[model samples]
Each structure stands twice: as structure tokens, then as C-alpha cells.
Target: MTQGLKIVIVEDDALIAMDLADLLIGMGHDVCAIASTESEAIVTARRCKPDLMIVDGGLQEGNGIDAMRRIATEGFIPHLFVTGDPQRLAQGAPDAVIVGKPFTMRELSRGIAAALASGVPASAD
Candidate 1:
């Protein structure tokens, strides 16, 4: 049996972040941290060392893509982008998974499962 995933949320929107956290926790995953800015996200991800990360496209301090890149370069967590704008994700780090905003719990669960199954390496650059 697969172990429960450890997750980190990087969303600027308080409500969305809380909702996602609640959903993931309800699904039996451990939420390590929730961050609203790029720097905080990166720091939290590094410190928490979670198995999965759900990041928003926009942040108060910087873009989520940049944070993803930094995390990748540091040889850390596998991450997915959750955003309303697919166009913004197009410019994201290569091979990054993009889960559109307004996603149902089922959709988010599926996306996380797929990302875990793929076993993709964390970004190296």
C-alpha cells in the first residue's frame, strides 16, 4: 500500500489555500506548510521536505514558477501548479504539472496521484 503523501501549499489566497489544505487532509495526506509568498514557499518547502507541493501561479512577493524553479534547483519536492490561468503555466518550469484552479477534490486527488505515480525527478535546474 502507498504511504500517505506529505504536502505543502503555496497559495496567496487564504480561502483557497485553506480549502485545499482541508481537502488534502481529509484525503489522508499530511499538510506540512502553507505559504503565501514565493520566498516563504521556498523556505517552507525546504524545511518541510514534503512529498508533494501545490503552488499557485501568482504570489504577493513573486511568481510561483520562480519558487518552483528554486525548489527544483535545490533538489527538493515534486510540485504542481494550481492556477486559473493556463497561459501563465505555459511559461512555467518544464515538465511541471498544472492543475487548474476551481478543481474539485476528486480532480485534485487524481492529479496528485498521477504526479506521484509518474515518479518524475524533482527539478535539477
Candidate 2:
């Protein structure tokens, strides 16, 4: 059997972060870390080295795009943008896989699976 994916979430909203974590856990994926600020997210991501990362656009210390860029520059990880602002994401993170806010579990699941199937480091570029 395939191993469950390890995921990290970087979302400032408490309810949304918990909900997303619950959904991912319910889907049999492991949530390795959840961060509310950009600095925390960066630290957690580096420490956890998750198979996939879902980041919100808005963060306390910095934006998710900055976190993604940091992760990319540091090394490799599958990263997806889960945000409310698609326009900004389009301009700033054109290459990222996006799952808009208020996304269904099915959508999130599909995005995770797709990201995994494509290979972890593949999405970084």
C-alpha cells in the first residue's frame, strides 16, 4: 500500500487551519505541522520536511509566497497555494498549484494526490 502523505499547513486563521488539518487527517494524510506566522512556518517546514505544504496567502510575519520562495530556495518540497486572492497569487506565484479558500475536501484531496503523483520536488520549479 502507498504511504500516507505528510503535510504542513501555514495558515493564520485558527478555524481554517484546524479545519484543513482535520480534513487532511480524516483523509489519512499526516499533518506534520501547522503555523500561523511566516517565521514559524519556515521553521516548521524546515524541521518537518513534509511531503507537501499548503500555504495561505496572508500571514502574520510575511506572505505565503515568501515562505514558498524560501522553501524553494532552500531545497525541494511540494507546495500549493491555498488562498482567497487568486489575482495576487497569479501575479506572484504563477507556477504554484492553487486551491482556493473554502475548498472542498475532495478538491484538497485531489490537489494533494496530484502533487504527490507529480513528485515532491517537481512542483517547486
Candidate 3:
């Protein structure tokens, strides 16, 4: 298996963030940081330099699409979006790898695999 990847989670829900962190640890991946807002996500990604990022498409304070765009300006980092409204994210990022909300482990794993495999770099535009 590949080495455990360092990851950052951008989720506004505290419980969900913890759950995601726990799940990632169980999967042998290390969660470097968790952010609850777009600004926080950008700062955390910069500080943590995680190999991957799992972002929520909709956030109460700040949305994920804007956060990803800002972070992408620094450099491309493998990432996936988890959201209830896939179409919304699709409209903003046509190439993004997305996992639906309330996903099973299998689905999340597949999404992560696809996200990692995708070569398209994140773009601000």
C-alpha cells in the first residue's frame, strides 16, 4: 500500500470533522489539520502542506469553492469535495472529484482514489 497520506479537512461541522479525522486515521492516513471556514482552510493548507484535502462544498461561514481556488493559487494539492449538492460544485469545478454527503466508507474511498489519480491541477479560474 502507498504510504499514509497527510490530509487536511475543511468542514464547518465539528462532529463531522472529528468523524472524518477518525475515519482517515483508521484508514492509515494522517489528518494534519481541520478548518471550519474558507479563510481557515487556506491558512491551514499553507501551514500543514497536506498531501490531500477533503473539503465540504457548502460551509456556513465560507464556501469551499472559493477556498479551493485560493489555496490552488499557492500550488495544486490533491483534493475532493463532499457535499449534498453535487451539481453546485460541478458548476464551479467541472473536473472536481466529489463524494456525496452521508457517504459510506467504500464511496469515500473511491472518491479519494479518483481524487488522487486525477492529474488536473486546481485552478483559480
Query: Stretches of candidate 2 above 4 Å error?
Result: 1-3, 117-125
Rank candidates by lDDT, best first. 3, 1, 2
lDDT against the true structure, per candidate, is: 0.80, 0.79, 0.89
- Going through the candidates in the order shown, the clash numbers are 0, 0, 0
Residue 34, candidate 3: Cα error in Å is 0.5
lDDT at position 108, candidate 3: 89
lDDT of 2 by residue, 1-125 (tens): 13488889999999999998998888788999999988888899889999888889878779888887777778777877788876777677666677887798777777676655654432233
| Model 1 lDDT tens row, 1-125 | 23488899999999999999998888888998999999998899879998988889888889888887777777746677888986657565556677887888777877787666665643434
What's model 2's lDDT at 34?
A: 94
TM per model? 0.87, 0.87, 0.93
lDDT of 2: 0.79
Q: Model 3 off-target regions past 4 Å?
A: 1-3, 123-125
Summed over model 1, clashes come to: 0
| Model 1: lowest-lDDT 10 consecutive positions | 116-125
Candidate 1: the clashing residue pairs are none
